[model samples]
Target chain A: MINIGVDLGGTTIKMALINEEGKMIDKWVIATNTIDNGKHIASEISKSILKKIRQFGLETSSVHGVGVGAPGFINLDTGFIYQAVNIGWKDYPFKAELEQLLGLPVIVDNDANMAALGEMWLGAGQGTRNLICVTLGTGVGAGIICDGKILHGVSGMAGEIGHITVIPRDGAACNCGKTGCLETVSSATGIRRMALDALDYIDSESILRTMFETKGDITAEDVFDCAERQDPLSSTVTEKAAYYLGYALGALAVTVNPEKIVIGGGVSHAGDALVKPLKKYFRHFSLPKIADSCSIDLAKLGNDAGVFGAAWLCMQK
Target chain B: MINIGVDLGGTTIKMALINEEGKMIDKWVIATNTIDNGKHIASEISKSILKKIRQFGLETSSVHGVGVGAPGFINLDTGFIYQAVNIGWKDYPFKAELEQLLGLPVIVDNDANMAALGEMWLGAGQGTRNLICVTLGTGVGAGIICDGKILHGVSGMAGEIGHITVIPRDGAACNCGKTGCLETVSSATGIRRMALDALDYIDSESILRTMFETKGDITAEDVFDCAERQDPLSSTVTEKAAYYLGYALGALAVTVNPEKIVIGGGVSHAGDALVKPLKKYFRHFSLPKIADSCSIDLAKLGNDAGVFGAAWLCMQK
Candidate 1:
């Protein structure tokens, strides 16, 4: 049987039809509108799925169910988007609306959680019962699987590793209104911000200065590139960010002690450049046994993780 | 039938005989000689258990099994003490030794993990599947329960909350050679140390100085008393410690999203003096829905949690 998978994001909605084997038989992407008129957006999502099904010459009856992965807090029981800041959604009955439009069974969960489920089923953590997936995008997103089950906690808000207090007393302010969250040091935007902050303190004899002048904006990529080119200031900034990110990961390891931690997202593109430093400092900060047993690896499946995981969720029930 | 429970600590070994109803039918305590041979300590524990059983009028055949709780890292699968610094134990086959002397099945686990299990089965978390137990004494210890099962990650070190870094950088040195560990800011020793450190910068008066002079040592109790009396310095120290601790709990809630958090240990005795501030800061730092559903309550089992949980462990399998 096939399942319909939807990857709901702030700017776009990606829909796919996946078979029991998790292969995407058909797919399409549509621009997402976050306006209060969610009915229009709901219709758009339905149309996207139906169009893909028709194009692939697949019968509607062949689909088993629909699974959605939304970016932000979701009530798994109610399928409610409790709050998604990026999409300006709050207490929205997402599943009800989508089901109303499509006339199908639907399960909705946190995006990172869905991605984690995907990894556990088909990606880096294929057979692992205890694993963690961390996505280092604009903001850090995490999914924790324990004993082969996703932990939704009491409010379905577990795996918010981004907000764990890396700097307790005083550090940079977070969008969560807290200071020194793990994301403030680990995310792509966080890395770029670190470079800009470092530019103020250190002499800017950096390749980043030249790149930024020409590119109009600096990215985490620019920072990593400059650091690799032996730019002292950029290396220091990247090292500092990696050090703290590792420290946060170390803290996370001590708390959950997952068997495998799969690091994903744009910044993970640096591969060993990011993970090497993370592993080094992670050991320094983590308990010896936990550090020794847990393996930190780059995430497989990339952006496809969301769609794959959503489909996997449908297959579960 | 009855079972024997032994809580092996660095300085004391507490043993109890528990009946089928989970009641302590008899109990005894003996000093532990850490510097002595391991077999001798095991013999003392066996002797203590026998004495407790004899006093309770229970025959050897009436005992189901033996359960022991030991501090520090433990291998649940092997029933070995991986490393226990204060107890001077490393890779010690304690359960095997105890079983040899007593001629009975023996089960062992980390002291805090078993304590939380004890609370989950018979105390504060009796009916809950997701609970976190934090013991705040000389050091902080945590035990996590998810979906009716204890979360003992791949290596049986899943709940090391004290070692997780609360502060990103430039915090106090932990005995484990790490900086900004939660134990450095939240333990009774941490709170008292904060009070002394704050005295160098602040000119606020405190009765704790005279109290400690006469008592020969200061403790979290003394700090709480001064805070209750509205001493500014003590209040600052306690509030700061509570805030950081609460912040970490808030961060932890986002990650674990537990149904309830049971606070135990000596410093927890400060009651509302600590909890009130902790709740305030926890809410400030946690995601809204998570902060609303999860609660911080005092551990009901007290020092007996270890014994009760140890007994319950044998009853389980």
Candidate 2:
């Protein structure tokens, strides 16, 4: 039997038909309709699923269940979304409504968690039962997999590693109303912020200064490009970002002691430029035993990680 | 059936006869014979177990197996001691040797892991499946229990929270060859060190100065006593120690998101004097949601936690 996986986001809704072995048989994406506070989302998802079933000439019985990776604090057992700031969802009975509309069992979890599960199942963390998957995008996010299971704490907020206070004093303010969070120094936005902050003190000969003068704003990509060329200012910014990220990972290494740490998201695309420095900081911050045991690697599945992980949720049940 | 639990430590060996319900039916202690490089330790343990069985008029067949909580990096599946620094054990076949000597199945794990398991089974973390148990004795040690199982990272070193870099720069040196670790500030030795350091900058009128002048050396207990009396120097020292500890715990709360944090060890005896200030620092450091969900409580089992946790290991198989 096959399973349906849904990667639900504020901008788009991506869906996939997955086989028992986690292979995606077919997939499609639809622009999200957030009209009327997303009241029609469940119906739209059901309609899409039915259209796909009819188009492929497959019976409903062929689909085992539907698993969704949603952006919010989800009640895994109840399928309730306590809050989703971007989607404007609050106390939404997501699972019950989706199950009713699709006439199939539905499972839902945090999107980052799904991405981690996806990596564990078919990406960088394959064959490792315990691991941590971190996404360094606009904000730093993480998902913890312990003994082949997602660790959902009492409130399904177990892997909020981004909010960890990396700089205890005089740190930048965070969106979460806190200061010195890992996200402040490690995320794509954070890297860009660091680059911008450095422009004032940077040497006039620096390429990053030239880029900032020409572009009005330097992105994390711009910072990486300049660093790759050995620009002192850009290299300093990247080094600091990598240090905070690696230090946070080191703290996690000693706490959960996962077999592997899978780094994902846009920032991780820097490849060796990011991981080489991260591994060094990780070793410096962790105990020798922990530093020697856990392997750090980049995520392989990218965006599809959510859908694959959603399908994994269906397979689990 | 009954299970035998051995809490092997540097100074003494504690043994317990436990029932299926996790209750300790009988218990005793013997001074650890670490002479001759600890070679005779296993045979001594077996002899003690045999003596207890005879004294209680119990049959050998009535005991299911033996569970040993040893101080070191233990290979849980193989019952091997990778390295126990205090006992001078290296690559010792702990389980096989003990099983052969006692004529029963044997299970082994790190002492801290056992203490955590013990607390989860019958102490402060009794009803919680996910929790972190920290011991703040001579050094800081931790045990992580996720979903009712001990989190033994790759090579069984998952819960080494002591070595997490709390002070990123200009922090004190730790025996682990790291700077600014939580143990360097929060452990018993760390607390005493802080107290001694405070003597230089402290006011001459402070009571701690008097105590130091009278005794020539102040213990961690002396610092706590002086703090209890609101002595300025001792209070400042305890506050700094508590802040570092709380900061480390806040990092763990965001990373692991355990339902509770059970603080064990000698320092925890300070009770509300320690917890009240620690809670304030934890709240200041963590995301509000995390600070609200994960509780910080004292460990209820104390030294007996190791023995109970060891018995829990035997019960698993």
Please provide, for model 1 over B145-249, each residue's C-alpha lDDT reduced to its tens digit, 9 standing for 90 to 100: 887778888888888888877765698998778888889989998998887777656655568766766887778888998889987777888888888888778
| Top candidate by TM-score | 2
Off by over 4 Å in 2: none
- Model 2 TM-score (2 dp): 0.97
Q: Which 10 successive residues of model 2 chain B have the least lDDT summed?
A: B196-205
For each candidate, what is chain B's TM-score?
0.95, 0.97
Would candidate 1 be rated incorrect, acceptable, medium or high by CAPRI criteria? medium
Give the Å shift of residue A66 in candidate 2. Answer: 1.7
The alpha-carbon deviation from the true structure for residue A274 of candidate 1, after best TM-score superposition, in angstroms, is 2.9
Could you tell me which 10 consecutive residues in candidate 1 chain B have the lowest summed lDDT?
A: B197-206
| DockQ for each numbered candidate | 0.63, 0.75
TM-score of each: 0.86, 0.97
